[model samples]
Target: MYPRLFTAAAFCLIAVASSKAEEDSHAIFRRAEAPKEVRAAVTCDEADDIITRDAFAGGWLWQSKCPSNHANFIKAQIFSRDKNGKDAKLIRFPVPRGTPLEEISNVEFFPATREFNSLFVNPEDESVCRTEARWIAQNALKPKLVFWRETKDCDGKKGWRVLKGRK
Candidate 1:
């Protein structure tokens, strides 16, 4: 009977330790800073608007305007080029409250020359696809080209696979 009791206690302790480890891992990932290139492309006003208005009551955040039905829950960070040819941001949109950092597939930005590139990826598929965006002078649909990508666990481990994107 005493041996059984000891085994049960050991199992409980192990469970608690595992849970704590998972939480710590997530915290580390969440604290990662956005790349400098991406940061430079965003504007302060854009970042402020994203944090203030677009963040949902539950903390889920995404880009405000969806140009098409395919665009939904689209969150992004913008980086632009400085006069020195380095990336600088006018603003930065942070990750929304409830979204896990690991679930983020990609962080994309339009470079100084108006070309877009992915700054980060979890699984690192290493494929680049080019899509075009055309501007409409007065239309609400500004015809902006958006960046899209999917995130997967690097080692096929236990983690969420998400379709992360930005414009």
Candidate 2:
């Protein structure tokens, strides 16, 4: 019985490893990971990287997003440079994760400048049937987390329209 159990466990581990490899290869699917753990779902070129202008400050914000499918977490890699324009530091901010299509979230930078972390829209908790997203504005002097106005679709999809860009 012990040998059989060991064999079964080994098989399960191999199967899990193979499945994870498959997900890694596929473009749409990403190996499920918890929030704050960084993983790339798509290639760097496919990532919607917002390059900040030199007028304000030279830096870039790469929001890890697929052109087609949206991931659970707002895995954004931000870089805020010094005046010299050298590689200052890489500030990676991962927003709270949400359920796959049922509960969606989005993040938009204010002024679209070379600054890090403006605002983010996400459900307070993914497990519950919440309507509004927790709109957090870090750019303001006193950062506040508020709920966005809710909108219901014909298909019973509750979504919050925070920023006026992207789906």
Candidate 3:
């Protein structure tokens, strides 16, 4: 009887931990609940979520989901300061049409390198394709495209290509 009780307690503890882990993994902001600047900068009619908002070089970087024409899409915008350190016009990037939101949703920032990175996996078959991209934010408002690599045949031995800058 004591052993059974111990096992039940342990299971309950594990369940609680698993629930917390999932909750912590996805920290998102609904469009309306986002900051005023974020709402103003976002042009979509209704955005489902704001996945990332990080301080970049001299400004901020934003990534959000905007659904339009029955299609879910992701958008990116950067804001930098002007000569007097006031907010300047937002710079919008046309995230390639049809690019899966999963590709850019979880943006990772590296303070030391001042770079943002993203990983992409084929939704249909995760093991068959993968892509990674990195962007460097400098003194200017524009984030420079650093590298974009993809492996169509995620096999351990093939299909690695550098589509843009160095990897």
Candidate 4:
């Protein structure tokens, strides 16, 4: 009787431990099965140029306009694969402020010049400022403005519109 009782207790403990382990494994698998979001703002065709496998290389260029300034510009170049398989983009301008805020009045893309130009109007006062032509490398994901400068005439902060690549 005593031996039978001991064996039953041991079996019960083993069964409980096995059940806990299975539950833990299921939890871990569930977490691992979740999907991840990819960060690609523009399609391949939207890029300035797309290179096939072994054609040239995978990379991209990004550009952003400065606030209130017509001539100043920011640009960056991003590579598809790093030396160690790490994908990264190099930022040319290191502005603390992210992207300028302006209501884009007009946008123009010059194929000959390979430049993107636009005119932005302040959302608050409607003050107009021209964004000079700037060239961005092809393949960049989403180039965000990191810094900005305010024009003497347009000193107020307002929203900005992106006019690049707009038809």
Candidate 5:
């Protein structure tokens, strides 16, 4: 009788521990809805469906997006906030018109170098274009575009042509 009671108690403790562990796995970051000014500027009536948010160089970067006609495409925008966390400003990526924010655009920021990168790839032909920028200073409003390139032709032989700086 004593041995059976001990076993039951041990099983209940194990079950409770596992349940708590599972609950903690699904972590969430609770942030207020984007400000009215931000929503108006981005033209997103509804609240931001945040894809990613990060803090860098005394400011915050928020990547909000909505789904498009295609599963792989999205209507995305990246907004930045100053050190005081006021006035969200859009970081523009100079891509051609009618181009949706597709998954091929791997937008990422490197903390070590304070550089940001975005790729615009054509799904039809797999041709790629990219933009690279670096934040000049901690109080800088925007990043300086260090490099940008575009691929105009679908032909595989036609390689990427530099847009601004010589590379």
Candidate 6:
């Protein structure tokens, strides 16, 4: 009788321990569910995905995509005469909200100048190309936020030639 009782007690103890382990596992799973901190990290990563590095428009232009519903498409460029001496803001502009950045588009850069251009196409119809896209100037001239040096002979007194110009 004592042997039978001991066996029954041992079986009950094992069953209870197994049930407790299962509950602990469930608690761990509940704690691992995605929290608010994880969501903010995903939101910040999205901005870095907006642009692509593949060159277009005669291999001198880079393509950038604007956020789907933003009011402006902001692009910033840094330029320098030397290969790595210093660089300054070549141009910065905000293409209109519907700038056609999503479609197959191309940008043009003047070979030795700070002038840059982009061909905006109709979002609904790709065939209908628009030569002129009104871009809001972030800065009328190359911003002086970078290292300052003597003005080159090519540049007039304005530090850098800017084109808020139409394509």
**Candidate 5 local distance difference test against the native:** 0.48
**To one decimal, what is the Cα RMSD in angstroms of model 1 from the true structure?**
17.4
**Local accuracy of candidate 6 as per-residue lDDT tens digits, 14-121:** 999998865532221121242222222221112333322221121212223333323234332322232221322223444333332222124444433334454333
lDDT of 2 by residue, 1-167 (tens): 99999999999999999988655432322223211222322233334432222222233222354342332333333233332223323333223343222112344444333223332233443434233333232432122334333333322256554432234
Tell me how far the alpha carbon of residue 43 in candidate 5 is from the true structure, in angstroms, after superposition.
Answer: 4.1
Error of 5 at 133 (Å): 7.4
**Mind giving the per-residue lDDT tens digits that candidate 3 earns over 10-40?**
9999999998865643335665665666556
Per-model TM values vs. the true structure:
0.26, 0.27, 0.51, 0.24, 0.50, 0.25
Output the worst ten-in-a-row residue range by lDDT, candidate 3: 94-103
| CA-RMSD of model 2 | 17.4
True lDDT of residue 70, candidate 3: 26
Error of 2 at 23 (Å): 37
Tens-place lDDT per residue, model 1, 22-135, is 553221111114333433333222212222111111121122211212222233422222222144322222232343221111323222233323333323243322212221
The alpha-carbon root-mean-square deviation between model 6 and the true structure, to one decimal in Å, is 22.4
User: In the order shown, what is each candidate's alpha-carbon RMSD?
Assistant: 17.4, 17.4, 10.0, 18.3, 8.6, 22.4
| lDDT by residue (tens digit), candidate 4, 22-75 | 553222112122111101311122212221111113422222222333433222
User: What lDDT score is found at residue 67 in candidate 4?
Assistant: 32
| Local error of candidate 6 at residue 133 (angstroms) | 5.0
- Compare candidates 2 and 3 on TM-score and give the better one: 3
- How far residue 58's Cα lies from its native spot in candidate 2, in Å, is 8.7
Clashing pairs in 6: none
Clashes of each: 16, 0, 0, 13, 0, 0
Candidate 6, which segments miss by more than 4 Å at Cα? Answer: 1-76, 88-90, 94-105, 112-114, 124-167
Ordered from best to worst TM-score, the candidate numbers read: 3, 5, 2, 1, 6, 4
- Which model, 2 or 4, shows the larger lDDT? 2
Task: Summing lDDT over every window of 10 consecutive residues in candidate 6, give the lowest-scoring window.
Answer: 142-151
Off by more than 4 A, model 2: 1-60, 66-75, 83-105, 112-126, 129-167
